[model samples]
Target: MSVKEVPEEYLSGYAEILAEVGRTGRRLTRDEVEGRRALGEQAAESGHGLRALVIRHLAATRVAWPRTTSPESVLAAVEQAIDAFAGGYERAQRLAVRKEEAARREFIDDLLYGRSDPGRLAQRAERFGLRLAHAHAVAVAAGPEPYDDTHPVTRSVEAALLSRFGDRRILLTTKDGRLICVVPADQEEVVRYFAKQAHAATDGGRAAIGRPHPGAGGVVRSYEEALNALDLADRIGLDDPVLHAADLLVFPVLARDREAMADLVDSALGPLQQARGGAQPLLDTLHAYFDAGCVAAQAARTLRLSVRALTYRLERIHRLTGSDPTDPQHRYMLQTAAIGARLLDWPAKEL
Candidate 1:
């Protein structure tokens, strides 16, 4: 190979080693092997191709071998040197990879948690293909089991996402045992696709996408929204595999005033404690009733009760609470209270 293809100095001392081994028939010393290995590591870290380095080392060995030397001993020395060199090269590459991963993880944590200065974070984000100035939306998925970057399910979702998007501005990672994807707000489909892939991979687990928000802090806001959506889904017993925070915004508003919500829950539903079955069955009945859109027949079907039985329960609720669930005006109060109860995990949670 020409000196231009492989650096001339790369072969400088290598040939000397081969010539010495050929002349004396003595095995290369530990220092000699270590020196070549260190050279390999330096070459790798400097972006030199391994293929070129190997070819150059082999060719130098050929030209440096003495005319009368025993081929067996020289060949053994060549094998040992090349093996040591390659081992060093590989070690250097692995170390670089680990460092890169660590940097990327730190950047992600800072970006999502708003721990870094906005200007500095925006500059750092560019290295990872994120433009923090643009609006971004975050989607989070939570499964029955906690997940990490190396999990098979996490890898599968990542592969699926890359296959579709070709590693664009979208970012995927795992945080607090959940999978998260952040994408530019304009690319709504990316976050949706992430949610779909995550839900399928997580085995009936739920995914939530937060509405798009702008700037560095917006990402944190969006991430928190997605997380809250997932939590709210669990508290309310929502069955949908995918949820959007936009649709459920009201729950947060109602829950913001904890004292008022607690009062509402007690005033609207507390009287059910006087019933024979206590509040749970009636609470469930109201849940079914509201979920069924005030359709008695549908609610009865959901509760596995006949319409007459369901009506009697509603009547009993009216008598205890003095609010008829079937009344349009009373329905809103009762429904809101039921939601508040679930959000506060009342009764069972002593809210």
Candidate 2:
């Protein structure tokens, strides 16, 4: 049947049913579907097709009408109206989901950056099903390469965290190049477990967890600490996939006093600044030596240098720096300076 022959009243009734479904945010019910079919029967009696009626009304209401008609053809034109209604409903749901997700991301970002007031944050948190009262720890996860907030790795990490921490108040977001999460505090084991899972899932990414802090403000503190630990892990070449801020407390402590750390770097390793080559090799050798517990043989093997060559370099460091690597007190001073160098990115920059 042709759409031009359908009565305007019947077409209006079908449009009303679709509008009702849209308003209620639900799929068409069986009764509604049946009513649509009845409308189609009436249209058929009036010598009109359901598809034409639907197309005209949808155009009138500013909804996109699907072009495919064969699928609904088998069920006749009545099914066409139902298909159009379903498509519109699904589209509306998708749009709603996108809006909600955007709002959620914004809320989390504000909370993490301390941009939201406590009262407003609490109210928003309640609406989002997040409990901010619990002690919380922040964790940062990343792959070897930089990634955006929408990277698959970030999404995978979020899913893994949710699987483990769904019952608790948890928030996940991505910033800069890393995935950040806030989870209930004092669950070091759970944090590590998910870190390992994310590492495997992302084909060898790693995570750093921060110490638990109380209250909403603590979330930012924990985030900062987690970032520090992540940075330190990269600088010191830690092999562990999951690192805890508590394990590396000294770095952050040293980091807090930049001036003092810079001075230490200058005092203990300043002589290396005049080395023929850049200071990095000597610094690497020293780090390897100290990391090997001041054992020449182990450090040499680690650096792929012969013992005599390692000894020569050590002697050169002693000659240039006037600090004996073999002397326990001097070794302590040099090791501390090396740590400071790493923290300050010394020699790479003017320290």
Candidate 3:
């Protein structure tokens, strides 16, 4: 639509996009509004990496405008940008493609580097020749070791989750598929709502989710809390959508998150605390063993026992706690739980 024919809102939207392009060291011409939309329309049509580039362009424009830019200037800019981008595919490629990659790469770089962005982003999707119509984020529910590693089941689970990103605009990749997500902001609400139900249907591994944030930068933020959600899932065996970043910032009462969990383990095994009287031998030994980094010899020494005697005690512990000392995974879990329990108030029901 001509700048004049375009509704003031839409024309302003085009301007907003241009202003964004300008803020990114990319020029925003009055012609780009029409250019970006036409390209957005094209990306919508290309339906792959091309579409991702299109969204990146739109996102960049949105970022530049900042919701405060006058609608007229924004519209005027959008019209100019669209005029250029819509005119041919080359400008869109040179502008949107590289910018998208830059945005994506910048995003991945921040993730790899442990940095947070103010919601601005860059992309690198064209290198893979993948087209993304839209973008959405996902969080994985992961437990300790085996479940945290790479597995075919995890890959399949991600694939399943990707299918549910509304228009199928997700690109699934994870470090270990353990406590991770794609983090596409576009489908945050839907992804948050359906991820649990969807993941429950998947095979292998357990996971939880945090709400998707606004942009590629927000995606990183979302993934940050995904780690916490994952820890909760591992500790509590939570099977429902029990957490979200969108709500978390307001409360930020995460310190108590694990408190409830610690309480759970305490409740489940609290009675044992009194069995050993003034000193709960099992718990004391468990603490020592864990503090000694699970080294049996060190633990035995700490417990002032012969190695064989420590073995016998551990065997009793196995029978009493059902937590296998020989199993590294379970051993660590119980150890962590025990340490967590120390922070809780163990009620005295009279020894």
Candidate 4:
């Protein structure tokens, strides 16, 4: 409906032609309008307006065309007018599609970034008849997938999929025009539904399959996990039918214990305060370092300390924890614990 209406000139011209042909108390001769009528018919069919001519002239008397009008002139006018109308329809369709695409992208970003409220998300879930499980596996499906960043099929397929299951839970986000659907752990049926929809929608693209997503919360990493799933699937051929983030939590030691991690960081550094004593401040310093990606220079600047002073502090942490601060593994353990400790507001554990 966003399309512009037909031009005034087109409407006026159509009426003018009818008047001219009907003048002198006689219709335009068959010879005068036959060629032009054919042209109008051709225009209608080519523009997906097969029934346009009938609709446009429904009220006019059908005695005969060209009885008074010139066939060549009438055909040219009909052709031009119909073409303009078709253009309006196409433009309207395109605008409506753009609006839907934008909404889809917003939904996807919110799930990935944890930026949206529960109400809006719930609205999407309800509209799609999505049944979100307590434990969900969220992932971004792409590559040979159903769409480019600017596609309409993705929307269509999504609408179809949502409508396909009325009692199930389904939540979706579309980034780069690819769908990120979150389904329940027990909902094998729903995941398959998504896969089918994706394949069907991705028509003419690479074989469509998606990647694993992150767990709830820490949406940034969850999003990364989803992207990695797609990459790994394309590169290593690991996932069947679809990929998921659970594949990446391969290390036992890295599995989280929220409360224990909080306790560990608290005890280890609580009494060792030169900057803030033992655990908490030292943990903050280490986290900043890792988050800045282990760049001591950037870490020092953020900590507002001279490079040499920050280096001395890092050495002290190594001595107290009996772990090398420079090691990637050590940084990971320290940063992870630091986050838990900071979030939990508990002291570090003694190592």
Candidate 5:
């Protein structure tokens, strides 16, 4: 059949599909691809060979300036155009996917960092398939080394969280070397389970979970709380794979008033500075003693010291600091000071 014999409607539909692919750089959906295939079949059944019709249509839609007239040459030119279109389609699909992922990451960053207003954040969340109107908690996971979105552990945790939370209600992303997730409040256990799985996957990494809070603003609060909980876990030498903010609430509260904590540490434990060795040994002894419930024998065993040596150390502590660990009131003050010291990292820096 001559090039002019091809139907205008079929040519126009194909042109439109090509135009869309060019304009938006999106891959054709399955339904659209199938529709075009069906059209090819229809053309074949109507006594026009599909390949011939395609070549003729391509020639018809070519740039206005003519270059060739032979049938074989036209066919070759059409084939080359088809190859170029396929290559462009593949590139466009990859670019589209990258753009989409970039957009999602930005939205997650903004939501967690409180960069957008609550109402707008909620709207954007909904647009991104997140339900922010309900109760939620923030969970953060850290590996031994730093990670970003491209890290294997981050991608694995994101996939695991989506499997549990079904994508719509959970927002998962990586920022500042940590994998952060916002999940439903009631799914704390599930979140913890995923965190443990991620930790194991990353070979002894850890995760921290915040207490559940309500609404969009609550997400930001939960994120902050989760970060504080992570810091406290490291400071206090916690061994659990998943640490909860509620469990470490006291540390954050104590850390809030830095000046008061400093004063308490100085007034309660300042005299220990005059010990023969640095204060760390005495501080370690006191910590072990308190951890052993003020039992000298248990503390001595833990410290690998003889009972007499432990007693001498305690006596020296009392002599220097005037706070007898055996006395309940003095022990309370001393314990508080020890806690404050650890919290503030006192004598090391102001913190």
Candidate 6:
């Protein structure tokens, strides 16, 4: 068979193989196989449909089957060429996927960190299904262990989000070992669903949702609020699996003035250090008392103590701090001091 006998458009150098095999009954050389692979890669890189390329090759093979070569030899050569071609095509496709993932990762970093110009960032965001013109809310989930995009919990959360929302202007990604979900502020249900799914999936995990804000900088602010909520939850030993930044706003306000907060801690809790077991026992008592709404029996149950024993501890706290636990005015002072101590991690580390 001559080169002209094969389909011209798709054959490329395939007809050369046929002519050589027809004349010599030889299999494809390594160089010829490599050349075919390179052609496949070029076809892939050029955006030619794989199916179309394969069909073209198959048609050329039929038209240019070498008459002199045994049918078995010709078929074997065709198989080797097709395998190499497919290999190259697959390799190219994988490379394209890796490049795309890298670009997406970079874009996410810039968007979340506010590292790019607002105009440019908003433009880039459109490619990823985000519209920064409207208000957006951020929710973050932190588990017992760090998570990545491929983690089972992360995959489950993504699957859930996609199923419920159908890829609506929602952006979900993992950053700094936590799962972050950003959605339009109006879609409160989406964030709520995410929190539910994330909490359910992470077992010993918790999720925090931040208040909505508008614009590119809003995303950063919401993300930081979610993160801060998580940090506050940990420090304060909050047990709620789903936390809202809005609900926890007071903690941040109370912590704003470091010196004042430190003074409150010293004035209200410092005296507890004089007790037999020191401040921790008294601090635990105060934490439980306030958490139980000053109901002596309930707080006793929480601390696994008799009400009498619990009241004695409260009495000791009152004496040491000069603030009565049952009195409304003194209770405020003690509760605020307790919150400050937790935020400052005082007693464990000097404030």
Per-candidate TM-scores read: 0.95, 0.71, 0.35, 0.42, 0.72, 0.92
Give per-residue CA lDDT, model 4, range 5-31, as digits (tens).
212222334555555644443344444
The digit string of per-residue lDDT tens for model 3 on 166-245 reads 34445444454353446445556545544564355443345555564444445555566666665654443334444554
Which run of 10 residues does model 4 get worst, by summed lDDT?
A: 1-10
Those runs of model 6 whose alpha carbons end farther than 4 Å from true positions after fitting are 1-10
**Roughly what TM-score does model 4 have, to 2 decimal places?**
0.42
Residue 62 Cα positional deviation in candidate 3, in Å, after optimal superposition: 58
Each prediction's whole-model lDDT (CA)? 0.90, 0.74, 0.53, 0.54, 0.74, 0.89
- Cα error, residue 84 of model 5, in Å, equals 1.8
Superposed on all Cα atoms, model 6 deviates from the true structure by an RMSD in Å of 3.5
lDDT of 1 by residue, 1-351 (tens): 343587766555777777777788888899988887888888889888888888888877767877644878788888988888888899999999999999999999999999999999999999988999999999999998999999998999999999999978988899999999989999998988999999999998899999899999999999999999998998888988999999999999999999999999999999998999789999999999999999999999999999999999999999999999999989999999999999998778876
Most accurate candidate by TM-score: 1
lDDT of 2 at 348: 85
Write one digit per residue (lDDT tens) for candidate 5, span 138-235: 88888888887788887777777667656545666777888887778877666776677678867898888888888888888999988887788788
The whole-model C-alpha lDDT of candidate 1 against the native structure comes to 0.90
Cα lDDT of model 2 by residue, 1-351, tens digit = 454554666654555544444444345566666555565555545545446766655554444222333323323333455564445444545566788889887887887888999778868887765567777888888887776657777777667767766655566667777777777786666667667766786688788898888777888888888898878888867778888898899877878989998999998898886888967889999999998998999999999999999999999999999998889979888998999998888878887
Selected candidate, larger lDDT, 3 vs 6 = 6
> Backbone clashes per model, in order?
0, 0, 46, 47, 0, 0
- Best model number under lDDT: 1
Q: Which prediction has more favorable TM-score, 1 or 4?
A: 1
lDDT of model 4 at residue 112? 63
Root-mean-square deviation of every model: 1.7, 10.4, 18.1, 13.5, 9.5, 3.5
Error of 4 at 91 (Å): 1.5
